[model samples]
Target: MRGFRRGLHRRSLYHRSLHLPPSPDAAHAQLLALHESGDANAAARFLREKTAAGSIFPGFLSSVVIDRACKSGDLRGALLILATMLHSGTPPPNQHAFASLIDALSKSTRLADAARALELMRDAGIHPDVVTFTVMIRGFCKNRMMERAWEIFQEMIKSNRCQPDCFLYGVLIDGYCKELRMDRALELLREMRVERRIQPDVVIYNSIVDGLCRSNRFLEAWKFLDETMVLQGCSPTVVTYTSLIRGACKAKKMKLAVRIWNAMLERKIQPTIVSYSVIIDGLSKAGRVYDAYRVVREMETLGCELNVVIYTTLIDGLCKSGFLDDAYALYRIMKRSGAFPNQRTYATLIDTFCRNDRTETALGLFDHIRDYCPLDVAMYTAVVSGLCRERRLDDARALFREMRLAGVSADTHAYNVLLHGAFRSERPEEAFRILEELGDDPGCVANLLTYNTVIAGCCLESGMVLFYEMRQRGIAPDFATYSALIDRLLGSGEIGRAFDLCEEMLASGLSPPSGVLGRVVARLCWSRRGDLAAKVIEMAMAVDDTASFSLPWDDEDGAAQDEDSQGEELGSIKDGATQEEPVP
Candidate 1:
């Protein structure tokens, strides 16, 4: 430690007897002046050079060194300076100095260093005050070290040096509740009330109820909010109600959420925008658009300013609940009411319209909103998807160009949508070109779905090239990739290649369509290659033991029996594969 070496240096300087000030008062006064001058290093050096070692130095002066070391961005240096003074039997360092050091170390996430500082504080004969203990406890809790925080709390009580206050209790309780350990949180709350006569406040009550509700203990949470906290004269705040309403909505109990909302009103407690947002989202998701409408109207009645989220959420609900016309009307109302709509607001309206096969309406809405809010990829992607669904490829392409010309880059999903449209419309070459252009555009990150589209859109040759590139890029092929390529190979009479793909598909933990492998097995058996037939059939049979999973296209039951019976069935199958009824 620098402090240890510095201590040795100070001891050596003690015997040197350098020229000095006439009195310790003059020396101390000079030291204080240098300390306040903000050149802490010079002060420390002056202290080491002039001050007599093994003498009773003032603790406050040493503490000034500690503070300057901490402020100078040298934490270990600060701790070392404190250690050197304590070891030298200097006057006890001030509690405020220790508290400051602890706060710095704890906040920097240097918990171990902070703990060492605590031990040094004790060695200096200074018991930690409430502020010091609270800082340590808060640090441990903030780092999610609940166990250590509990240990610190127990240590505080055991020391009898400081008592835990409401703020301290709140910190630990909040930590436990956030970790979803409601049991520990409640136990502490009960102790604070019964053992210490500390009345739990609304913030504390809100935490427990929020924790319990999020834990899906809806009955327990509601009982606590309505009975336990209320009877104790601890009123629920808007934050408290918002939690319960959100919890109720998550539990799909829309009626209970509404009840909480109404209960808040009856108490003359004003609900905030967040409170309205939670219930509105819940009611709209439950297909009760009109109920959500009532809440929105209530906001208007109370002169509460409507934001885009409230409007978008309500409009989405209206669209989802089959009140599309109402959704459009609300959009109109939102605009006329002077609340500027964001891209999300327009996207909701346009997306819902497109999803409902109202592409023309969606396009109209898109054009209308363009002059107001800037266009985004989601807005264009939605309409592109809708147009592609309607097989309006030319219009979709035109919009795609317009999107880039407007300085908005198309995302991966947007490119995937356009490629899929092209493939569906039998424009394979166009799809390939689009995929090539997608690769050239660094902004796009093609996922597994993107590759699957390319594979399904191409011939075997181009598909094989992409499949290799896909593997080199570390994208694993899925059933769709194998299905498309294997179908193409099979149709072109590439039996060997098709069989290898089937084996690969099976090895990849995906079942090749039973008919594809079964056809190969039948053909091999027809050719009297019983070994290959048995090998293929064995893999199929391992995957399909139940009758429901049997090869219903032909008689595949005989292969499910023992070896001898299987051979007999195969021989029969071979015989049935005559010229009139050739093997599929």
Candidate 2:
């Protein structure tokens, strides 16, 4: 009764198709359903049970199941199914199905599995079809395994079972082109024409041209394009012209691209969105925003509506040109025109706002995104970093917590914000606790900022003892770490100790910034050790030939220091009298 009930429950979940089709059809449908539902085990079980029940299993179904399992990356399951089909006296289907299995294995990107499938096909007395050869060749070429693909092609030719058609040649040409093996693609093309008696089509021609263009051989690609135009039976498609224009644009030969674009117009061929976007992106990247804008106007004139990507390009251009207000206005225009802002839009806005010191505006925009839109971790991190820079630690912490609650895993940048906030609140123990909490996250260990922030905190609150502890924990100190140590030592009036750190920085090939070196000089000057002070000034001059030092004095402090100095080596030069450096 329990078994019947379980069967009923399982039946309830399947289709109620009254007439049973062939076992292969039903099995194919069930397998497809299982794969769709992500129930690989159930799919496998259905195939086993039906075959065992003496159902008529077709060879094609077995081939498909094998292909399905291979493509799904379940090699063991595929082997089990293959064994069951073999035992059931089902012959492996037509050459097409066997080829499909090979294609599936190749698409899975498992070269060993593909090789094994190919071997199994040969052993079963099923020869690989043309599609099989093409797919395997393309797959090997994609992985830069050209040698293997070439060997298979040679073997296929030697077997004389199938002829290499135009499609096959196209596949190999495209594959080699994609791998940047232009020489191989060209050689294959030449062989196709002269040796194999196969003619070049637009696709084969385009593949060679595109490959040459990608290798920065625009001149070669162009020369080939002209050669293809004059080929006896080949005619250039719109795609051919677009490919040349795009290649020229990529090589930043805008004049050539424009000429091709005009030629395409003369031929009455329409430009695709990809072509427009490519030119617009290139124009914007090259700081030719005016040209990019002109393209947008041209697109409008051509009755092609501006897309979000086009507007984003315009916004980026405006922002780069120091027109943030204009960028913002264009952003508003983009929304009004029914283009939704994607993650890049948000990131650009946040970066622009922060750079303009409009931190509140950036945070407000971020807050809205946190409540709505699919959240991007990078966008959140950028905002968190801006808040930390602005010293709004509490707000930064709240956002960090919100990100975790939203099911976004806290990356190292988020952790850095929390550590910075903890330090801002003067809770070194809390900061240390955060680092301890991150011990389980392997990704956190690779974050240099996280390591630097925590190391800097240790140097500030605890000292080198914790700094060494951080090192023991496998956190390597960066330049910021050394700078923090120098800062802490200098703050404590340990100039000699600070000099040791300076030496360490120099040994590590880190030259402290001029501003930081200025601070060190100021510290020495205030110490009244005139000899050491002169040495620091001379060192600073040697490092920066253009730098000149002038002692800045406040009128009040100047009067006080002049009144107090009896001798250069006076112990406790009387606090009210010693010259204090003017605060900027």
Candidate 3:
């Protein structure tokens, strides 16, 4: 296996490039040594070349190599070994080697290749055994190729060399069940009993029950478990009861779930952790927290310790009911009882605590949990957002840095949170640093919200540069994007450019904020640029008739003087934005 992996990395196509013995027989010996020493690639190529040259070798050695290659997932290598055996023709390729080849091909979902290999085996006058058919049926069933699987089964029956075993029938039944064809699955069950006189076991019945439950045929599923399995003398396993219990939970039939649990116990079947988890989760989600506690007590009676899922589910129920104190107490109990909290466990308490104005408590809990499990991105992001909300920038920054030290990478949302917090705290340089840091992070990609945060926080010139970069990256700017740019433009006395953006915004099927629009045209009329102002109102009236507000162009009401003392410079700026000027 190691040699095969090495050969794959070498990029060489043939054994000629490899160091080997000169004589073909000696070369075969070296190949065997490589095969034994774990060099699959070189060994495979040597066999292929020897087979191509018709160099004689033992068929048993070829079979040994073929089986190992297939076992190691080297299908091409296995085929080469088979070819070498066929070419030598001393003891000829047997059914076992072909069966192994077919099994490997089927597992790889190369159904066509498997079929061809089966044909080759038959043409060589070697027939397939029960093991061969079983593997083929299992492969087809696994891939949901029931049609081809049925064909193979029928062919096997006609051959009459071996009778179909219970396992083979189980595969076919399971396949139909997974496909949700319960009618066909039922037919097979009947055939297994009436035609073959083979009694169905727990596994076969479990598949049918699961299929019926999944199809919402609860009554029929119960009938099979209660009547059919009992009559056939097959007892229901933990998995059998769990499927029905899970189905009841999904349907919100808590009464039925509990009844199924009791019935399983009546049969002296001990419920697994999964069975308990399913019941606990169902009860918790249904707002039956106290009843869920009863189930926990039952678990205690059996000396079954609670897991993270059980604790987390109950804690979530308590938290949802606004019982924060009880939730925290349960969290402490879980930690003390050897059930380590997962991300969901910590995140639930932290988020609820943060949301309910208990930020300090959430941070304390987070600080404690960090020593147990390496903090994930979600937990770190939640705490950072909460810290930012409380304006604790220093603590948030320390935690952000600690994320990297803990070998956890900050995602884009975390970066955006810090960027927003920096700006909200009036630290623009720190915000820029965050943006630059995001740029260096190959794992994180900035989304539209990130760009909006940066652009909203930056100066007009820098914001414009960043906006241009945003569009160049193919992140389409929304109304918020244009609104931010235009608002900055208007505030900076760049009314002409702001109006241009307003046109772009309208042209892109976006209605700029009415308040921003009115401000833009009003400033244009105030600047004595009546013609430009008129054009802006004309376009505005097209999308929204109310946007063409009546301008005081006549000055009959004694309006103030024009604000454009530097009309020529304003015109120059209007014609083209210059590098020296900070045009909005």
Candidate 4:
């Protein structure tokens, strides 16, 4: 038995040598070693040389090297290796080499190469197997080339050489689901069971259920869970229930999540760590932070040890809901419970405290993270923004300067946040300076939102001058600029000037916002330009009546009215106006 085992091992090593042949058997051994060590290029070179000497490299070794390269996301390298192997007088092309290449190319996102590989396989007189077709299907799915994938699938069925397996069915069905083509997903599901006579396994059912849930077809998903799984005596596993819970949470069906949770508990379906994390995340996202905490406590009571993810989720949820104090408390508790915070946890805390204008606290937290978890730009930005929000512009500016000294260039969002803080803190000049700095940097130009923000800030105190400066600097004004101008003019009771600007905006080929126009109308009415106000109202009506006046003043009354009555009148006016506009 020992001699047989040694012989088997020798055969295994020699089989690997055919794909990567060196000068001598010893060199071949070295080449095989490299291939075994995951060096696809060396293997390809060696195989090519071996084939040139009229030696046919073993099909399995070629497959192994190709597979390793493909799985490692080096499809291009794998292709080059295959080409080398082909040049070497290796055995004529076969299904395994071609099929493996196709799968590799597809996984590498080289869709065109994948298709070519498939064609090459067919040309070499090797019909692709189910694995080949399935691989191509997955590639098409990834590229959103669903039509092409389906075409290949049909061909696979037509050949009838290899039956479609559950894995193949799962890929196609899931692909349809991903595209939100629930109808097609369902059709595939039914066909697989009825026409194809293949039993849908847990993966198949999970794919369908998940697809349905993701599409927000909860009722249908539940029906599948109830009828298909339970009625068919196919017990649903943790993945199915977890997906359902997560989906229900995303759909904001808290009640349904509770029901699923209870059912899982009763069935003794031991929830994985991921299941607990999903539920905790769901609860937190729903703003039921307290309920989320309750879940954590329950896990502890049930002796289900919580992971760091659960603590982070709880802290993040508390912080998002303006419960910074509570988040801090949770952080303390998390430490006491012996789960050390990760970088993400520290980032969340720093960001939360900073956003809530707790710059000191945020800074302290950042300092702690800097000592433990590595701090990133987000951490600094949060603290900077917080400082700015608290009117501590000096501290914010100092932080920015420090970030620069540390070789950290500001991202667009970080710069915009700082600019806003400066603008709000009565430092529009500083805000303008920041914009000038940003304009000099080409990397910050894609997001027009940042431009809008800075421009809007310029509209604050004598901000019109800055707007003119922006125009002179060749920066095009977006709808946001017009919106800001309209808002500023309306607030200052400069109705006539605001209307003139609106006209200019229209002349510039800008799309008019009904909301802004409606505000203009209200301002005109306040200025007692009843005729123009009525005209503006008509224009507003032309665009959207649903946004018509919600106030009692019309083009006359300037004083405040009862909130309830005014709200009702506004609703009535809007509803009446909506009924009049054509759908086009």
How many residue pairs collide in each prediction? 0, 0, 2, 2
The CA-based lDDT of model 3 is what?
0.78
Q: Each candidate's TM vs. the true structure?
A: 0.44, 0.54, 0.48, 0.58
State which candidate has the highest lDDT: 3
For 338-409, candidate 3 gives per-residue lDDT tens digits of 888899898888888887888998899888876787779889888888887888877789999999888899
Better of 1 and 2 by lDDT: 1
Candidate order (lDDT): 3, 1, 4, 2
Which residue runs of candidate 4 sit more than 4 Å off their true CA positions? 1-45, 48-56, 68-77, 92-116, 139-163, 227-233, 285-291, 297-305, 321-347, 359-584
Predictions ranked by TM-score, top down?
4, 2, 3, 1
**Candidates' C-alpha lDDT:** 0.77, 0.70, 0.78, 0.73
Clashing pairs in 3: 3-39, 4-40
lDDT of 2 by residue, 5-53 (tens): 9656654444442246655456555655665476665666677677766
Please, what are the lDDT tens digits per residue for candidate 1 over residues 48-155? Answer: 555336545567667766678677766765666666666665676688789879888998999988888888888777899988898888889889899999998999
- TM-score winner: 4
* Candidate achieving higher lDDT, 2 or 3: 3
Better of 3 and 4 by lDDT: 3
After best superposition, candidate 3 residue 288: deviation in angstroms? 3.3
The superposed Cα distance between candidate 4 and the true structure at residue 361, in angstroms, equals: 5.7
